[model samples]
Target: MTQQPIISLRDVGVRYKRAGSIFRKTQYYQALKSINLDIYPGETLGILGRNGAGKSTLLKVISGILKPDSGEIINRGASVSLLALQAGFDPNLSGRDNAVLSGMLQGYSRKEIESKLEEIQDFSELGDFFYEPVRTYSSGMRTRLGFSVSTTISPDVLLIDEVLSVGDKEFRKKAEQVIIQKIQSQQTIILVSHSEQQIIRLCERSIIL
Candidate 1:
């Protein structure tokens, strides 16, 4: 029996407008055009492209952060989360607080978030810094905390956008291992990456934007 798609997108297109100076007319760019895709349950799909090729834009649309300018998206009622570097965090909040906030934003209850706090803290390996304001954190520390929180929540549809490159070598290895485990457990994922090797290793199928 064939598997059903958890999300379906047809004739999708996204456009952006650049404001014009007094001397020039406004210009518009099409970020994505005539895109059609079906994301099946429990499949890892890699989206590959260079900078400004709409890979991130496509993920945002699927995650419901952006609406396509000219097409229909049918999400089969799956909960979705996007894990982009520095995307969902508040700089003034501590890592622990951010983790709680992130979980809540992903549809978890406050009690559930509180219960997972310890696990998220341990997985992030942020130590005492987990209680410190995120603004004081280095980029790598923020990445670790963000990755831990997002993975812990385990949304039905996870969207990752160029976040694998955020941390140090050791942390990157750990993050990659976690993602591999998720794939092994048959979690559905849409990954946007500029790294060709990473895509080939983690994805069963892929498309270039």
Candidate 2:
């Protein structure tokens, strides 16, 4: 029998209005137009597009952070998480606290999130910096924590938007290895990347925008 889709996008469209020049009227830009897709379980899918082609927009839509201007998203009880850098973190909170918060937002209780804290801390390799406020973190540090939390939570559907290249070489390698293990374990993933080669290497199927 055929597998059922964990998430489905039906005739979805997202538009934004941009300010125009002094003489020109404001214009509406369609970030995503009439999108129709079925994201099945345990499949690694790649979205390939140029910088302005809405790859990030699609991930945001799928992650429910952005509502489409038109059509419907049907999520059949699947948990989706975007491995977004510096996302869902409170600048005033410590990275350790933020990790707990991020997990709770994804439906875990405090105890559950706390139980995984040590693994998250070890994987991030933040050392003492993990207890520092997020506002003190550099981009690399943020990436490390974000990646660690996202991976540890183990959401049913993972959305990765070009995050593998944000860290130092060693950290990047480690992050890639974690993703590889998830892939091997049949995790459902939606990856958006500018590098076609990377997409081809990681994804079972891909679509070009």
Candidate 3:
């Protein structure tokens, strides 16, 4: 029997309103037009495009952050996570607290995420810094924390938007290894990147916007 898609998009379109110069009327633009996609289980899908091609927009739509102006999305109870560094984080909250909030946003219960808190802390290697407020963290420290939570919470569909090259050199290596392991372990992933080589290496299928 043929496999069914875990998520499906039918005739989806997203329109955005943009301001015009002082001499002209405002206009709307289509970021995505009549897009139809099927995201199957255990597949590493790649989305490739230049800047302004709505790559991030597509990921947000998949993650349910953006509602399409037209068409429908069929997400059959599967959870989707977008790899965002600063999303859902509060500057006043400690790293640990933010992790819990982020995981909850991914559809996990508070208890479920708290159980994995130690692992998230360990993977981030933030040590005492994990208890510190996010405002006190350096860029690298913040990146590590966000990356750890997003990866550790473990969603059914992982949506990455050019975040694989994040953090310092050592951490980047560690992050890349973990993503490789995820791909090897049959985790479904949708990655958007400008790097052709990365797409070719990690994705089983790709689409260009």
Candidate 4:
């Protein structure tokens, strides 16, 4: 028997309003055009598309970052986590502070964040700078810290939005290992990647957007 889908998108449509020029008329841009899809438990769903193909938009919709204009999103039995770790980070805050903040956003308590604080710090490897402001971090350092803190609290549904390009080889390796272990443990993962090799290695089924 086939397993039931943990996430179902029925006749989903996402529309965005375009920036109207002084000389031109305003318009509503269709991001996702009457799309329908399902994500099953214990499966990795890979999403591929060219730029502006609504891959990120789809992720935002499922992650509850964006609301669709039409259709219903039925998410059953799984908590979702997005790959955009810095989506709500404060640049003025220290890395350590951001870790706790991010944990809270992911539904973890302050005590829970404290418990895993050491692991997040160690994995990020930001050294003494971990106590410094986030604005001081390089893009790579920021990515490392963000990835470590975000993935530390595992979710039933993981959404990756082409963010692998933001980190170095070592951090990427660590992240990949964590995700691979999660996949083997039957967690649902939705990954958006332009790399075919990554898709083949990590996902069993893929949807081309």
Best candidate (score: TM-score): 1
Error of 3 at 145 (Å): 0.7
Those runs of model 3 whose alpha carbons end farther than 4 Å from true positions after fitting are 20-26
> What are the per-residue Cα lDDT tens digits for candidate 3 across 1-209?
17899999999899898878889999998899888999999999999999989888889899999999999999988988887665699989999999999888777899999999999999999999999999999989999998998887467899998989999999999998989888888789999999999999989999998
Q: Write the per-residue lDDT of candidate 1 for residues 45-101, one digit (tens) a residue.
A: 999999999998898899999999999999999988887444469999999899988
* Residue 39 local lDDT, model 1: 95
Off by over 4 Å in 1: 20-25
At residue 6, give the lDDT of candidate 3. 94
TM-score on alpha carbons, each prediction? 0.91, 0.88, 0.90, 0.90
Which 10 successive residues of model 4 have the least lDDT summed?
80-89
Question: 81-175 in candidate 2: lDDT tens per residue?
Answer: 88755557898999999999987776679999999999999999899999999899998888889888877767899899898887899999999
Could you list the CA RMSD of all candidates, in the order they appear?
A: 2.0, 2.6, 2.3, 2.1
lDDT of 3 at 64: 92
3 or 4, which is superior by lDDT? 3
Candidate 3's displacement at residue 43, Å, is: 0.5
Which runs of model 4 end up more than 4 angstroms from their true locations?
Answer: 20-25
lDDT (CA) for every model shown? 0.88, 0.90, 0.90, 0.86
Native-to-model Cα distance after best TM-score fit, residue 164 in candidate 2, in Å: 0.9
